[model samples]
Target: MGRQEKVTTSLAGTVGEEIGAFLAPVDAALERDYPGDPGTRQPVHTVYVPGDVFGAGTVRSWGDRALAALDEHAPDAAAFAAVLGLDGALAEAVYARVRTKLEREPVEDLRVDFEDGYGSRPDAEEDAAAARAARLIAQAYEDGTAAPYMGIRMKCLEAAVRDRGIRTLDVFLSGLAEAGGLPDGLVLTLPKVTYPEQVTAMVRLLEAFEKARGLAPGRIGFEIQIETSQAVLAADGTATVARLIRAAEGRATGLHYGTFDYSACLGVSAAHQASDHPAADHAKAVMQVAAAGTGVRLSDGSTNVLPVGPTGQVHDAWRLHYGLTRRALARAYYQGWDMHPGHLPTRYAAVFAFYREGFERTAARLARYVHRVGGDVMDEPATAKALSGHLLRGLDCGALDLAEVTGATGLTRAELDGLATPRRGGGAT
Candidate 1:
């Protein structure tokens, strides 16, 4: 027999060069920011305060105010406890937990708003407001009361407000520089971004500010708020979220959804505008796909419904906010905006409940997979990553304790910690 032809099945290249080339920068950017292993504390929610009202003691005051409001709104703790599924004692304890969390980190992230939060004022008034915000920010830093993530939200890059936005940013940053330096994790929120050029221009301005202040380049990160249809879809009808991130050129760290603004842009009536609306769902889906594995964090928008009632009973609104928070969590958008203090209780309730409810099952699956035991269900590496991520998020968010997680996962605290660092590859497509 003729020499048997040696079987030669050469593998094709690992991936198309064009695809690799396209992904190279995004991969690099992901490594640069690496949202999963945030070096700093990541706030569960951000609280926006008007420019003139923001300052050092503001966080503490806000917490105190929130507690007071909670007391008045939920005069019957038992009733509120029933709603949260906590017994009287446990309910009080959870209430205490909320109070403590608020007092300790009332605002994990703060936005000194110069846009909607700070209504249009005269130019001189705006300037003064910016200066006041700067002083307050500096004072908060000095007092160590500032949230881990803190910054200003300037008006949009629309032609009408472009100059004003730039001026506001420059003034606040300049004032911050004069005072000392920007706070750690400081970032600006550029709202209603509709084009890549807008983000690019903002990045250039941020770079200039960094250079002018003698700070390190790329230190001034900004988050893009996708509120308009144009923001998500390019003129050519392609998804623009990735392009928007690229436009930041390493200065972008997050993409936050703006519910009301987005709904309005889509012509949804105020009555129909909501976080759970299909339009919001579509926008969030685009954001997830665009930012996933790119290191740009995603945040859902706030509900306009405040947890307050004319009779000072906030049970109904509290329930609504809790449901909304749970919906966001279900969608895997862990972060959202908090418009009122009453929203705090429901936020924690939903997040903690999610972690706790899944902990046992997730732990069992992880343990079985790790031990190579038969459990009727096979677990893959992705499963391991997901379990680790869920537990780690719970830990990071103050929802689950290290001890509880360690016991459940059959892993040492250190081992679990290792898993917490976002796995490098094989993420969801």
Candidate 2:
């Protein structure tokens, strides 16, 4: 069999066995203790926050000032747009108009991403400064004053580092380690990851580090940024992403869409295209398909065009634009990202609305399915198999919660235990 066929065959067998085993119940006590409601478990959405948002000088003060500004304007659409790197005048006008009706809603996770080559590129002085900046940010988290969960993006491995025969990547990661234990979880955003071997190589280095630090072997997790054209066009793109996730195994956390880079790879003009552009949607779909249900989370890229317009019209335009993108992401099951405080309310509003809507629809479907598949114990393997997969998916997406799902579906905790099992079949569900 060819590689694709081989992969397909292997996946089918694996998924089938897993489903069968998972449906079989565990000890009654174990079922009660598991936190997942199966029916009502919603996907967690992580929001990405840019590291460089705090101005270049006097980092703490800059951060404080930015926070203050966000506090004042986050609820206002225009103000939020302005803080998101949009023009100032226009952002203010929008803030004035939308400030009254907004509420405070913040997601749990916030990611701080480093600029390209902060660690990997040449320039001794520049790299040192970058290291210092990273340390400062990590220190902020260590102080326990930042978000509850925080993550950092590391530089991707580059050709120059490879050519020099210097373990530049190692040196950079070492600096981060010295700064502090990994930040909540490290998001090693690998760019241009075209092959599985690249992921394995990074994994080897992480393993070495884990041993040196006496940390558990699989403690560090990663989030791959599928940016390059080559990565998207790879013969086994989904499989490649899966391999990357497996490299981290217990450590793999999530995957992020790189809108600009992926667009560039497609030979599409990057100018004026927002993160929610049609091209971006296509890219996100590919990523979603690749990450369907192995439990690894997925994130959509940022809206590049910060909304900056005078009058409520400008701010409204910006909100509508961002709202569309936010809607798209929530539709695809992504959580959150690095947004200005001003944008927080919108992010919260959009995400909450999406989940509320999804839950309602999914709940109905699962309720119907359970009723259709009544409790009669069956002997036919194929008939049992089809019903099992359908029920499992319904439970996974919060369609069935403990109280409602268990009572209505007649699927005991024992039957739901297998829902978390990784299926080699597809991506994040």
Candidate 3:
């Protein structure tokens, strides 16, 4: 035989020290179907309210108001379903379910903002608001309607506003502790983060609060808001999402994008600033890439085009919100901010329809792939993950039942349960 050329690859040249350590955990995370806590139910949208009007009963009140508005504005599920391109029969089912879901529990997460939502206020007023918020927290727990996820959004740590932000946070935390300590699933949101030091400082402050308030260590976590060009890219043109999260020192649970503010940073005009804007897409893409397997959640910004004002515009606005919500879903951005109560209907509609419209078809395909059936069908690990993701997401959010998923996927209950989980230590099926 003729002599063959020798082929050798240099591992060090291919992957440096940093890449190796990063990949180690990433590979382990990928072995599972989903990263982070699968039991953690990520709300479809976060409802933001100003600080003054926020009280323990606020969420319940909002649910009632939202339901009333939904009935008046979007009474028929069939109509909204048509707007989303859902099948007539399936659309009705989703509509009916969503109506009940909203009536029962409308807000999954609430943010009492001391930032733009509340605007500037006197210290006494701010303190009063904080106390009210604390009472609300306690009330929510007692009533059993407290959202599974809830938090307060303080103003940025900028020099001018940092003191007020700190004061508000301190007052709120103190009141919350005095009332009944921090509740489960509570987080503090730090917005417009431009430097890693901001995160480090906030973490230190939280630690101090935990100690003073007699709360468990690390009981409070914060979500970073990526709203500036600086957040998307450092001065050296490197992505800063991972750095920002690391600066949190293990307390950063989620990173949320702010659409209008981010767009303004890019100098995009008001008319051009949108959820699907190129600049917004690029920034969020950087966030997704950096935070991919780290288990730090990512949320897209809100759509400012609200469904209020005129009768004609309301319908147009609803359709626009759904389109934007669907756009986020397509990019795997499951969570976004809903600025208005009206946005709630479209948010749930888009999410339910996304999972429901193709539930049976996707499940059947997955079943075929899992069973190794051949009929011009092809599947990969990613395909399995996608199918499992929908089923699990639906289940977690109350959109799909175990029976429905099992029946559709043709898998036993045990196998069905594991569908959403990453198939670890097993050969590819």
Candidate 4:
């Protein structure tokens, strides 16, 4: 055999060390600012209930109501498939899981609204409602009937409601603390955040609560609601939404796009205002970029064209909701807002179908990537990670079964998770 050629270097080793030293801060910044997805179960939807109306049975009641909607309108898998134009192969899987999901766990994330959905209540009334919400939610968690995540959407940080928002937040958190400490899935949302200062204020407020309550620092995290035109673009023409995420100081869990309020801000007529609007798309696109790799999830807003009224109207509304949910999923916005109980049937239907339809193709691609084999579509590490992530999300939202993903991909849960997780500095090793 011929001797291996000796490697040669033109530069000294010190040159490499100097380059590393120069880029150390940049590396640290990337690590700090863009930590990637938290690898937690990001819920498919967040259901908002007015504070005055939310009760202990809200979760179960919503489930039952959604199931009833299905029983009335969809009736069966074939009916729903026809309504949403779902492929025949996906009908049974989507239908059975939607039914099972509604029966078992309908609302994955619940937000007790003290903001728009709640409107303005008298100070005393609002205070009592906040406390009541905390008590009820804590009890629900204790009873094992709680959604995976629960919290309040407090009023904005505007001058008129600044004090009210803070007071409500304190009352809710204090109430939970007094009841039996915070639950594992506790969430808080600071709504209508138009400036980075608002985010910093929330961080400070949470810090104060931690200090006062003797809790660990940074134990409380909250979502920043992006619902204003100013939040998407600033006076100086920079992306303020990105600044908002940074201002959260590592405590922001998600960025929720608000449909109605944001549309109204831009003078988008009510008739034309919807989650699929061009204005909403532009704003969410900015949000998607701002939140990318920040470990902050993005949630598309809800639609006011709710599924209600007569059978014909309900069917139309269901189709719209299902299409919107599926559209958001395609755009990589994994979570969304659901305002009406009637919307639940279609929400699950869309999510389940998306996962089911792509199951075979995605599985084959991942298998080929793992085995280093040839296929029509060449898959790389990033593509494999995305494939695994899609499967995990499907499993998380009950859209796809674990046994099926593993059986098809020939990959274990741990292996899938490792691929789904983003490695430092990204790209293939």
- Residues 134-226 of candidate 3: C-alpha lDDT, one tens digit per residue: 778777876798887887999889998999999889988888788877787687899999999999999999999988877788788889999
User: Using lDDT as the measure, which candidate wins?
Assistant: 4
Model 2 stretches astray by more than 4 angstroms: 1-108, 117-138, 161-180, 183-185, 235-243, 246-250, 339-341, 356-429
By summed lDDT, the worst window of 10 consecutive residues in model 3 runs over 31-40
- RMSD in Å for all candidates: 4.6, 11.7, 5.5, 1.2
- The regions of model 1 sitting more than 4 angstroms off are 1-41, 75-78, 84-96, 310-313, 371-376, 410-414, 422-429
Candidate 4 regions exceeding 4 Å error are 426-429
TM-score of 3: 0.87
Native-vs-model 1 lDDT?
A: 0.79
Which regions in candidate 3 have their CA more than 4 angstroms from the true location? Answer: 1-39, 82-85, 369-376, 410-429
List the global CA lDDT of all models: 0.79, 0.50, 0.81, 0.92
Model 1, position 227, has a per-residue lDDT of 88
lDDT for each residue of candidate 1 in 178-243, tens digit (9 for 90 to 100): 888887757789998988999999988988887877888878888999988988887898999878
Q: In model 2, which range of ten residues has the least summed lDDT? A: 97-106
Q: How many clashing pairs per prediction, in order?
A: 0, 22, 3, 0
